[model samples]
Target: MGASQPGGPSLPQERRLVTAIPGPKSVELMERRNKAVARGVSTTLPVFVTRSGGGVVEDVDGNSLIDFGSGIAVTSVGNSAEAVVRRATEQLQRFTHTCFMVTPYDSYVAVAEQLNELTPGDHEKRTALFNSGAEAVENAVKIARAYTKRTAVVVFDHGYHGRTNLTMALTAKNMPYKESFGPFAPEVYRVPVAYPFRWLTGAENCADEAAAAAIDAVTKQIGAHNVAAVVIEPILGEGGFIEPAKGFLPKIVEFCRENGIVFVADEIQTGFCRTGEWFACDDEGIVPDLITTAKGIAGGLPLAAVTGRAEIMDAAHAGGLGGTYGGNPVACAAALGAIETMRAHDLNGAAQRIGEVMKGRLNTIAEKNPAIGEVRGRGAMIAIELVKPGTKEPAADYAGAIAKACHAEGLLVLTAGTYGNVLRFLPPLVMPEHLLVEGLDILEKAIAQVTA
Candidate 1:
């Protein structure tokens, strides 16, 4: 979708429900899915979306539900974004699949150039494209390991990387994501994250303590020389959008530098202006050795990348990094259009506007609902932690109930965190003001209902 011409009809902004949520058509599809699909796979929401655009998902049931999850923050530009669709369709018309490793395309090179220019860090950089966030993270690890000639990788508690074997080792949560899928990749260690609201120590000491504890773990267990990289999300994504303390990131970077440990910023969820900035790591002014991104890249097409210092990236010998679908021509085309759309419409500014509106509404809810313990996050990626009154213990039951209520009210929301007590809102940056406010109102009512 390119920019609108002089006077085309503006996109519709309201949710129009012509039938009950999960109406006849959706129910029929679910029945078919259960019979044909494997039961092992998991789903966050039940409604089957037939068409999506702007800020809403039109379910097969004919109910238009406001989308706050953005397909888990994938469709940043918007579902069926005109620019992305146009570019992708045009590219597809030319050719479907050529396999970059076999035959390269200019679009792939263009995408890599954009990542090198846009990603944080002013140093000379190079990028490698991949299939998913986990693939990118895995590739980053390969590069780090090859560069540093080390095997150990460290991750923080409550952090989520992905579901692959190595990433499963990096992820901290046990249930759902990693449950019953054990025997994960080895040489991975976990340390406590600076979770201020729930942490025992004051915010003043948490950052230093967390950093120290991690360094200690690396030194005592694996030794600094044996470690390849320390991976972290500047603003934890599924880990409740928890913002680390002021000095936390810098200390980590300093420690990494001293130990020659590659600091990998897992920007899969926090990249693409989702957190008010181009990358959340930029806010701290820390230059991670490597940055991993996906989800929003290519405007929902499967594309992920690892951008890092050229030397480190070059450590991988010939044919060391790449995938069959990595940098698919159509996906690259979509990414180019997505980047243009973000700049043309100033979606970053819109994300800040979204954050302000969401914060105001969630703070008001926290004031009235004792179950809400914290309202946190930056930009469009925001979350509210639920807890019992006068205690810091997570209230996952209340969070689940609230989510169910929101879905029933035609507002799609998602829950995350190790305890599953944090409700995260990841609405598209193109979301209309009124629709966003309406979703917030629904969220308030849902929380109130659950609390009552």
Candidate 2:
């Protein structure tokens, strides 16, 4: 038996494989998916999930795989959490979609109130609801531009905001995300980020130097006056779980504050106790002018929010800041339920425990494996950057081999980093400690077998 949280009954939290990774049933689903689904949409493990919760995803073939990726950090409170299921089910019976913009709803206001209270800082804040992380991010940019009436937005290297047109421009990657999707929004600038692992001078000098470079680029190249916002992921998400050097974030935040540029923290993947804190920015006590949230906000429902200084969030005209289905009553209910689960389970502390376990185990693995470059991140969001045996060069293929091996063993994991050489883990905060330990064991064994 695995640990259980009062947040509700979760899956057994065990890894059970009735057949191969992509068993016959999953293969049938895969065949169907290939025919109907767009080719642009790709599957990672290629198994159709029948059900999921706590720490495992039950595939169509009866294979219950340990879930290390919480549907890209969306199921942090755990799938079908009691409050979530109960509230969402209740809302479903009552009404599903009465757009907030048209009629408004109490649950939507309730969610905004929670976010205002939970997010970093005690300042008066306002929140606008949206449907996805991308939508929320784009809206954040718009709000910044509207409030400041500026044209340029500055981002950092290895930052990932979203897939929308403006967000694609905000994103630093090229191939998969922004390859052919050109004519992207203008005035988006990319700057250097303090990446301690990859910094040329060394980790000791990373914070000061990177911050200087970033600040220099902003002032000299983009001119802070023209910059509407400076968007950054406190810990790089898709670009690898690269936590900026201890002092880097504060410097940037200070710079934006001094220069009148809005500091927008893209907390979509790092918020909601996923990072041990309510928001990653809270770790450094660096409060952003605007914060974007999604993924784990509403249990498994699609919901996103942008909470910020009231003046900035309210700058947009009333009719300008909403969508047809933004903050659907059902989704708002789910968000409230998800928040209840977070509080009930003390998921923040659970994330801290996950970080302790994952980092300790991965660091131990790194001590023995020369190919494992660096083990870094906070809370439940962690990653190991793969590199050549003796150098900092990314070992992309090595990462792929390791991930493939884990998948073969019924352990689902995801890879990230601009070089595609990082194995990122975003386990549910309610995941059983046994599952966490076992997942690390599988990862360690995979590394050994690959090197063998």
Candidate 3:
């Protein structure tokens, strides 16, 4: 066991491969999973985890792999942070579930108060809890439509909201997310995003030109007046860790304000200190009319929230926004614990430090490898785009090969991007600096071996 925190469980921090990638125990579990689990439910790494803490996940076969994905940015304070475990355990011992809609709980109210205080704007905000990021996003749209009395909603290119019917229509990607599952919700509009690397006009004009084009599309096609909300991921997550051009967000927010369109920030992946700030929008000082959160909100618990200005949120009738398990007491307790851990450990600052270490190391790797097209993102949410040598053409195969190599070598990494050519890193904020450097070292070797 590794050194224990004040009240947290201690797991070994070092990476140790006791057997081939998927040891016999994991192989047995894989067989069981194939028989019991649905094919639609996929996994990045197939190894079955027995214990995980800090920066490492130990599989059933005793292989401790460095966790770089953070369960897709869900465990910012590590898998078993002391505060989270303590509060959640206490809540579990007591009453577990009492639907907040039927009998409201203090923990749910407390979590709401925290979100209102933490989210960007301070103009008397309100919050509604949900079960997942998709639910929060769907509810945010509901609130926006109710408040605006309009039907059309606008989403950007390379943006990912969720997998729900409405969010599927809102999402930009097609292959796995939206393929063969169409018949999506109507009145949803798609527009170009300020993607600097892929912008045909050049990176310099990406921010201004993309914003102008998107605004024009809304004005001409959707007629702004018919649009209820302009929902965006400040730092695109599953669509790729594509950070929009610096000034693009402000421009879009300004346009939404002028058009009376509610600006919604789907910070599901980039919120709660994942982006070195409370929310990615803070980097640009963009105050969204509504904000959706989930992944890291409750220390791995299934909890999500939609927070916004009181006036807009109150537009919905009393019973318009809630579910049976919307704010389960146990999950609310976990959220409170997670928030406490974030504040106590300064995970926001930790994310910034992680970014500094990752970017510095990855940039050096990029300089040596021509396949590395660009290294972008802020704080702990960073990624490297792979491309054909000497050209911008995406090298998705190369990215996949590198990710596989990293996994084989005991470093778990994930791939993203609309083209599937970007290697994204979302290490837990509590990860030790040494582990980060070691993981980067493994990544460098994997890149070298694959490229060679």
Candidate 4:
């Protein structure tokens, strides 16, 4: 049996290290996993987890590690949240799955209702649940096409949609996600995002001008009348949490409105209060025609959703919008609990507090280290870009070494962005301030040591 954590039944605050990171047991299990699992799959951190709670993950080897990655931002309310576990367990005991499309259930409808009410905009909205972020994104494209009767969809550079065929086409990065998986779906086009940190045009360019250039490029390449939708993450996720300039999203929305093209926000990674707001798009007061969500929605359960204006969503035929396991009852139950936890704990507020702490520390480090290029993100979704001193050239190898050092010292961080030189932080909103500070100290020391 795995070790039982302390601090009552619900929340555990301890990080107990019973053995080395991949001790004898974990190394053995990893070898087995390699044989059984596909080689295409990869892991970002070592220390295989068997159980997690609040802010810590307990590995099979019985070492408790502070989790900064939050299962890649899925466990926003924290792992094994009391409400989420209770609701999921109860639903499991009662009924596991009824296949919502075959025989609808109240839980599925309830989840849909929550999406409608919670997603940005006061406009009348409709929602459909699916099994993953990729599925939700694909379905949104279908809905947009049905509504506009158009063939073209536009996505921005550095934006990550998902892994499915259509979504892989939507994703901006070429390798890993879209590699070896193409012949991708056609009618999908890419536009450049105004990444102030790396844009050759310079950050001094106004948001409006940058946006106009992108819009003009799209209109010139593919007539707006032929475009069904333009999808984006308000703050790009895997592509380095790049937040577009102030006017970019509003400009895109205005262009979409004039052309009758749908605007979809892929909030899978930034949703559920990860960005200090319910939706990252909320920051700009932009209401997307359709919003796709997954990551933190079901509190670690496999559930995703597409929420949008009712009229646009209804364009799809009844049978065109569902999956066998869409809105699984247990997952819906977990979602209900997750939402409740967010409200009760004020995870949005927590995210803002964490962001202040993170940005403050990272910026302080940047002041001292010439190798640090940029620090950016909102709320809990933060990243630090590494570069060679006095140059914009990326230092991916240096970043990799720093990450390896952190792992050796029991801290886990993830690398992202096209250049692979940015270290992104996705700590659970429920993490303790003390633990967060400790991790920051370790991160700062590692960078100092490496740069020296």
The 10-residue segment of model 1 with minimum total lDDT is 1-10
lDDT of 3 at 181: 99
Candidate 4 stretches with Cα past 4 Å from truth are: 1-12, 16-18
Backbone clash count, each prediction separately: 2, 0, 0, 0
lDDT tens readout by residue for model 3, 298-358: 9999999999999999999999999999988888999999999889878888899999999
Inter-residue clash pairs, candidate 3: none
Show the lowest summed lDDT stretch of 10 residues, model 4: 1-10
Q: How far in Å is the alpha carbon of 77 misplaced in model 2?
A: 0.7
Encode model 1's per-residue lDDT on 1-452: one tens digit a residue: 21231001144556777767667888888889899999988677777877777787887777888889998999888877778888899999999889999988899899999999999878999999888999999999999999999999989998999989999999998988888998999999998888888778777788888878877878888888999999999999888889998898898899899989999999999999899888898888989899999998878899999999999999999998887888888889998888887887878888899999999989987888778899999999999999987788899998899999898888999999889999999998888778898999888888878888
lDDT of 4 at 44: 71
* Minimal lDDT window, size 10, model 3: 1-10
The segments of candidate 3 whose C-alpha lies over 4 angstroms from its true place after superposition are 1-9
1 or 3, greater by lDDT: 3
| lDDT value, candidate 1, whole model | 0.87
Cand. 2 Cα-lDDT? 0.91
What is each predicted model's overall lDDT from 0 to 1?
0.87, 0.91, 0.92, 0.87
Off-target runs (Cα >4 Å) in candidate 2 are: 6-10
Q: Which ten residues in a row have the lowest lDDT in candidate 2?
A: 1-10
Error of 3 at 95 (Å): 0.6
Count steric clashes of candidate 3. Answer: 0
Listed in order, each prediction's TM-score against the native is 0.97, 0.98, 0.98, 0.96
lDDT, ranked from best to worst = 3, 2, 1, 4
